[model samples]
Target: MGIPRALLVLCIATAFLSLGPRGSLGRSHLHKRQQSHGRRGNGGHRLQSPVDSPADPPAAGTSTTVTPSNSSSDSSVFDVRSFGAVGDGVTDDTEAFRSAWRAACSVESATLSVPSDGVFMITSTIFPGPCQPGLVFQVDGVVMPPDGPQCWPKSDSKHQWLVFYQLEGMTLRGEGTIEGNGEDWWSLPCKPHRGPHGSTLPGSCDSPVLIRFFMSCNLTVRDLRIENSPQFHIKFDACEDVHIEGLSINSPAFSPNTDGVHIENTRSVTIYNSMISNGDDCISIGPGCSDVDIQNVTCGPGHGISIGSLGMHNSEACVSNVSVKNAVIRNSDNGVRIKTWQGGMGSVSDISFDTVYMENVRNCIIIDQYYCSNKGYCQNQSSAVYVSGVTYANIKGTYDVRSPPMHFACSDTLPCTNITMSEVELLPHEGELVDDPFCWNAYGVMRTVTIPPIPCLQDGQPESLQEIPNLGC
Candidate 1:
């Protein structure tokens, strides 16, 4: 893959690269809950969640105590304070947390508690699991790392901060907050807005990604509040059967690259009812992802939900069977986007954006075949990631007049086909101006009358059907 894709998808990089074997860590009694699958007009059916579903996470910002299920509450409790954590906000509490986890992991149905009241400061840490049975990582107190880049250990990776590896049948929910002290990292001269005139900074320019889960299955993260990450807030990479709900991810509008939730090389994921106000993409779907369902998310002061930004470095990328519905996007850079670099090789298909309300959003609905994160991340090439079977339905709201409400800037050589738009009534300048939408090499049908009427879409299929092989995960 290319360097741009490598920026986010590269194993969080170097400091810890060994994945010797999947540990025999954790598992709880499994259960399932039915959730709505698709948007309107499809007569959506309910889909059952993947096996591992313990009790729900605590509501965001609430101080609800978590108790282990089917186990004596007192006996199964493993408290960090009891393990010698001072919790005074400045002391190093990493060992205490590790001790608590060890005790909790030894027992079946145990809860590791970072109870309410203390501000636990710890360094970059990894909690590797496969423990006994089910385990709960309860965070009702404030958890943060050392203040800045200078405080970070050179021996530790700048790419990862708090990581959970090989954990299954686990629930990480709490009213408490996981604060990412990202300001200094964001201030590095190498960062976008911080770069000096034609000058480069010394040392590593990487910032720690806050809270990541790798090679885990049947995971649940809900009702949590994460803020000001040096990078992404919550990322699930190479994980399966995941469900994320009721999260509030926040950062300054200008905070660099603080994506709310990102998933890559993962499958069967569900993100529901989350409120994210950040600086970058509210949620990004990277390569090798499928069967994703996102609903009732409120995103703003950030870039909207996106797919790909893929196939960079002339690599094969595939994403399919994704749906985003009942979402509210406001004051964001883009509404719902499908982006790929010029020379990308795979395909993006079977995507839907339904019943999304946009308010003053720029590039309300867009497909950019020539996507570049920075000024020159990727150079133009003839080959492109094929895009097809995309639907934009019932998307209504006011939009920023600076850019086109709906833009389909497909590849010059490989046009986007099966691009259907229905009941999309976006009016520029706060529901008043009727600017014409833009389209280039995009072919599809408009089910009903669009607000400004898109007369630029071509009326047939492309001749590249055989070019896109189904690369399902």
Candidate 2:
């Protein structure tokens, strides 16, 4: 087999996330590629090969001056075009961008700019920091990576493409697009697509994450249009005081592993005024995350905003204080979900979703403690993540009748407690009304009447949770 169709997925507990094809965003479709893996046609744009460096300065007319707001007129602006970037669709502009970054990183409040009418193709790139504060990355034009897997840099980790490390007080905002030519990546057999292999296989399928902010702080990413990532679109890991605003992330409903906004092990986050549609979750808050507020989000044709698939591989994970409000989810698989695996230790609490509306979604609200990667049969284990203090209010939706609108399948040994629901009305979009909600070993109440009334929820805490044992959570 040429690539084993890249069969295999490994989430080491030890590891992290995946792409789904449950609705429009799953990697499970088994469609053969009509075009073989190769560099893409430039779509009327001329193509240029990568160069080691600029042998000469920019020809002219491509350079532009940039002045940061609230800064002196002398604030340095470094344009990539000035460093010999041919922003055609197929030029190797990686070195040009790096040189501009160096020049801008040296000075405080410097602006690194890209031309508004260019399509610069870069390779696997990392922008490391701890440099000058308030560095601005302005993307008024399109910045994209090499076309597909074969075009990817073999020496680089296939797990990640563009990465920013250890940056502080950096702002990345623009009116342009960061396009991921991900069609080839999504074709790998390992992606959760319809196939003989089912959804997930056990092994390694290393698809690159589009953009990652690692160990950075006080970062701002706003007003960007990102599309068709090979994997997770934007990830902030181990970052603090992060603000994401006015961003639109889009990928094909059938794209694999293309989560819109995924934040993990990060805190003090505010993701506001964003619209996400893809194959996976619109916004995924992963382990070690806290103090996250997501509002005014429009999510659809994907997995809904989720808090976890945490506590995998018997690992310890903790997530808390996440709030999602004033959101709309349409034609999605799951909405406002919390999923954790068995035999894991951790706690997920203080999460709330309020005033949200859904349309034609499969699962409007859910919590799955028996989450597994389908590696094999996950043996039922006693230990589980502690889930509590989750609230859902004013969530009205039309749903697909295949699954119940509300499913709270808490762990058998460690039942979920303090669950609250109010004014949630879910009805079938066109078919007959589905069954009542499915609840097991869950403790909660309804402050107001709900459609298909949930009489299955236990009114009091489960006796199994009376003396909660701390499993190093």
Candidate 3:
């Protein structure tokens, strides 16, 4: 017998409910449920689940999912554009960037992508983090600051811009640009581009560093372009285990204090395969640095790689185990230098500069122990930072005719010792006469024949070491 209509309808409804939704309909129902629960998308205006959930970990090499702001439903990448960011280069995207960083940094093994094809204008912002492991900050667009110093807010931090503070296991890598727009800052009356006959200004004259990482560790910054900073382009302070490669740093040759990369109190750093051209030192290694390796660098239109200017203001410094090899420095002020001020105590040892080629450089190889650049008078003191075990080998260069090719102006009381030079040659570029290498209170041995002659360096350790405490070769 045929079932009654009501009974048949009831049976079909029961079967459908027992079996649940299938295929496309099931997926659609789940999507709607996630939407109702306020899940956000990961990338490109798509929907995604909340990052705080105990979701399944991503597969090997797969990007971890993050729920971006605005709850865009569809993808698993956290795109900054979805979070109320107008990339028109005018609107302030600072808030959006901070929000994105917050959301992205919350999840373990996530990526925060900055989309391309537009310029993102951000004011001075700090991305502070003790974020999860494997966090990737991928930038594929132009991240520019305000027009110049005139547009900067008075209350903003004058010491730093774009700071990544206290972050670990972070990677900042991409094919993008970070523009400082520092024309106005450079033109200030106190800067090198001093206004109106280089007159000094009385007001606060401090400028911000473009990118700084302070008290952070295990960081990797690669494949990026940083340009036109008001002060130092990239600075790492009190950080450790950093790797910086494939970078391009550009600024005006006359812009003051625009050091390409300045590191202080940092260790285990490797800076390789980079190009740096700025007003100040291409790579400035400050005190408390060790185990640093810099190679395959192209530096010009700036001061060459430098160690110290340490022991300044009567402070002690200890630096060791630095190696710079396979570098080309052209039209620079100094090729390889180790400078320390008087009235301080410490040691700089186990340093080597090898296979360096210089062109038209002034003071190709120098060791200035009495480094006094300030206007104040510095009294002669027996205390000094001891310089020893420094080897300069395979250094071939053409120096400017104005200054001596090699200068070693060691301390009078605490003379530098154990300095070695091998296969070094420096010829004058402009004139026929080559200036002599001046040596004062420096004791070392020459390994081979040197151009322009370095016969001034004495043999064996200096007798002054017996008088100074904790001093040796």
Candidate 4:
């Protein structure tokens, strides 16, 4: 006889519980509700607006509160030490957190508070639900990983270390750090390397992301510094109502696949007042995400903010309702980019980039449908995705190289359309702009750019000295 799917899932959950701290036997209770019918796979069903749900509102004159310092002002603040957790940074504090979270499950205004100047080593996942309103994971100190690889769970899953899944109305606040001692994990031996960088040699390295959130709602993470990640710094998947502010992510500039932040399959997310410096894209917005706003961000020595490289496998993947404004990028690969894979299906629309400052940029603006390939050598002849309804305004930047200040390469199949640009001026690096200042496939059109004289087309000019146009301005 074979075990049922739900039973199999339960067994996995139980196994995880056994690895938890002593006396912190957090049990998993399964309750089937009609709402479960709407959920899909890991890529769950898209969520409708909260107004469309039939849920009742909170009672009038009732509000939740959290008190971090044990003031007499709130009844909801709970010390994590009560659950046997020590925030000494050296102690294994995973179990204490589990107990605190479990106890908060029944409270309307519960908080799992962490005292200042201690390190809490986390080895397990922290799951918070809607009932735990005003739930705060206040980290005034560092939340560090266990010392060695042996202390971490030996698993093949992507989230082998620590992860947060399917929580609501939760906030992670602190003037602290989430540190991943990634030298061991990322330097592990793996095959068919899966990162922005190409395949690695045997016994080389495999980068794993530090933090990941899946299918969560109403989440806020503020005033935190995440450092030394193996792969992507942070990833949010299929989450809604997410806000991240005043966060700093720092990693080695040469770290492979260390994307600063990635938001995929989500909605209503805002990332603001953040500083990110990594090897890969500072921010990457994947498919099925919408209503994203990024502001007051400073990125450098990394790939700039991008939309797509989408339509990888499926026929439809939509990325819409995005705005990138009031940001600064310096010494980066490209300032603004939109890329899509060939032979996939989807559309990118309603996107806007405004008030961006770039300095010493290799390419001030670029839309490369032909991405992730050797220079000028793309695999597929046509692109699988569609890009349209994009606007770039008030872009002030400097180009470091003679490469084009702006380059747009749309797919021959689904050419880019409905694009507009205004007040986008690219100062010369050493010479003038390309005379034609435009290149387009048969299906697309290049409009709105003021052409300039093409320089370095002949004579002793190096191939790198050729000028590309700043079209659409």
Candidate 5:
């Protein structure tokens, strides 16, 4: 037997969701419900609106200049307009942008500039590079896709747009916007079914991710505004030494699969001082990612940060040395989470979530090993991913009254071990009483008394690992 075909195929298209986006009741209803349950005494604050900071990226079409750093010996600049790019949003700028990239990348320490007068309409394109040292790709105007899904070229793969491939020593920064113009794509009959009463047709989903960096290293992307992506907003795959900061990502809360930032097969990464609100995860850490540091992030109106749905379909996965601190997650589905599928083998270790504050969050801490999607059929499997050395410390929050504050549903065959939690306190946003935590096949110690307490956790791993008959992966 091999990995399940359902999991293997769906893993790429829908990584974080088993079901579609929940029908939003609006935050006002939740606030009133919480107030009715004596939530005023629970110390949970009201939900916050999207934040606008002074350091945020400038509006589109703002006048800005792209310049090389003082350390650069070569200060050549390549303007896209000089390469025959019409700044009007109607003309095709894909070839022009590519031409500019080639010229700037050929010269050492150069800057590729997008003028700030108008929108630059571009098709799905790749900017491949072994670019000159200290290269900068600066955007100072709006860059957008075609009008809608109807205008999309059938020849292009609907899986990706705006690819930055195989680049080194690059900085992509500016006060401009990369808009996906994805309103029509989200209304596809097979995509989450936003029709009458959420009805849908049975067909394939072919939504594209907005921006991606593949096989690149030593990159910096900062001070950019990204919006209305068809899928994951920004993805970094097989890249190293990536630094991202001062970004704002926004989308409707019902846009499916719009993870704010996703990293896979990447190392030595840092994401800080950002705001993300989408229909899916704010930050999703995938397989082969380690030495990651995330701090000073604000997330809401979506799924909070997550690690994995890793090792799906019996694939090998090993993730370690991740830390998240000084974060706020409010009015979201789940806070910090780790989810994996059954019958997969590998390990996730050395992770910590610290100093996280939550408001009206559902399932603030979770690890679900039997994660399945689309109500897919999954048979019992004996092999499991080993989850160990995870810690949740200084976590204080008010949770939605409907579900328990924490849930750990580990594999029965290979249970999660060495979990540690301390200074944890959770109360209902609407109720005076806190819900009890749910645990199964997980071993951990709590350094302090948690609200409602966790008594379902057993002392150690089960003594059996023998496989039963007819278990499929």
Candidate 6:
């Protein structure tokens, strides 16, 4: 008896499950039906079934097949050149995108394809709304932002850029790049003035993110290079079931608040097989997020993956069941950090960091319950964000500084608890561990194989006052 071709394809996909980056497992495979229709050829496009007409309900028992259509479709793919989009490598291609988007919406399983050449300038937002399932926004050219400040939209009612709102079953894939002409937006004159903690700046001038998705679901973004945004490169807010893989995001090292990936109030988000270098935290998971997993990511020259910096005034947030494993951090500010503002209300629990590698990072591991504002100013009100059940296992790293490799600062009011560390080893950059290993003024208990005596500072100062005290373990 011979195996059916569809069964053979399924077996092959299952075999590739563990071969690629950790995030690509289980979900990256093309649907067996899609493969049977036609083969995916050059340029990373997949042939997909025609999208069911809007009048029809989605295919039954076929919910898992909402992947994006490939670029090499026979007739449904939109060639940007046909719609007056000049690929001369210098013309503004924004209008070309608008035209292509408009045309793709009319067809079932259509692809808006941009061939590999030219720079397209996009000054306005392109809305691919009421997107049908199996629709793909494929880019093979560069999408560049307007050159200077004059081109950016002001915050007034007149200025509105790109946005993807209330769309379902969409896929954005490309081998090209999206560059935000950020200098113009970042240098706006009407920008907010500085405050005591840190100066307020202008809201991202609609040029902050090369791609923005809000209130979307079943979205997949893969195999692209996104660079140079005035703000966050990719931001997902209030979205669900989002999968991002095989992306390379690079930007200037000093770009302020240029977090590589920011997910707020989202669920079931997975990020894997990506390299992120940015000015702020490579990945910041904030309030109202759950079931988030990050694996096989490379991070360096950024703030590193962080949870919380949460509990802002009158805000209610919770982060749980988050896991990060098999990651590499090089010369980052901190590894596996959790921070919360004082006087805020939230709860972060059931978090785990496993098999993480750190090289020359500033702080190998940290949890700051008293995460004060800039300029080292502490809030008079204490934190209400409860931190508990954080575990660091199989962590091996080197700290570039002489201080204790591990630091935990819990609030005086709601102290952190149930913190555990196992098989954690840290090599100091300058000196050996200090003679004592205990927390300072922290309300929670510390458990380890050996609790060394707390080190006394030269001036008899409390542990909190001492900067980078030696951990004598």
State how far residue 236 of model 6 sits from its true place (Å).
Answer: 0.6
- Please give the distance, in angstroms, between residue 43's alpha carbon in candidate 6 and its true position after superposition: 32
TM-scores for every candidate against the unseen true structure = 0.82, 0.86, 0.83, 0.73, 0.81, 0.73
In candidate 4, what residue range of length 10 has the lowest lDDT sum?
Answer: 30-39
lDDT of 6 by residue, 1-473 (tens): 99999999998998797566444323321222211111112222212212222122222222212213222324566656545555443445555567667666666687766655445555657475786678887766666655545544353222334567777788888877666655555455333333334456445434346567889899888887877667777888899999999989887666666778888889999998999987778899988888999999998878889997787774666888899999998878887899888777778888989899888777777887667655346656744677767887778867766555677777665656666666677675455654343353343322333222223111222343333212110
lDDT of 4 by residue, 1-473 (tens): 98999999999999888776423433222122121111122221122222222122213232222223222233354455545555544455666666666655556656556655455666646464545566677666566655435445555344534566778887887766777666555545452254347654565444456888888899899988887776788899889999999999987666667788898989999999999988779999998899999999999888889887687654467898999999999888878888877766767888999999988777777777766544544467553566667787888867765577777776655556656666777675556643333334412223334333222112222233143222211
User: What digit string (tens of lDDT, one per residue) describes model 5 on residues 389-424?
Assistant: 899999998998788889999998787887988998
lDDT of 3 by residue, 386-420 (tens): 88899999999799888898999998878888999
lDDT of 2 by residue, 181-210 (tens): 888888876668445747655445788999
Per-residue CA lDDT of model 1 for 257-345, tens digit only, reads 78999999999999999999999999999999999999999999899999978988888888999999999999999999999998888
- State which candidate, 2 or 3, has the greater lDDT: 2
Error of 5 at 200 (Å): 5.0
Off by over 4 Å in 4: 1-75, 124-130, 147-151, 155-160, 185-199, 202-206, 373-378, 381-383, 428-438, 442-473
Measured by TM-score, the strongest candidate is 2
Prediction 3 TM-score vs. true: 0.83
Point out the worst 10-residue segment of candidate 1 by lDDT: 33-42
The lDDT of model 6 is: 0.66
Candidate 2 lDDT score at position 77: 62
10 residues in a row with least lDDT, candidate 2: 26-35
Output the TM-score of candidate 1: 0.82
The superposed Cα distance between candidate 1 and the true structure at residue 443, in angstroms, equals 0.8
Model 6, total clashes? 14
Worst ten in a row by lDDT for model 5 = 28-37
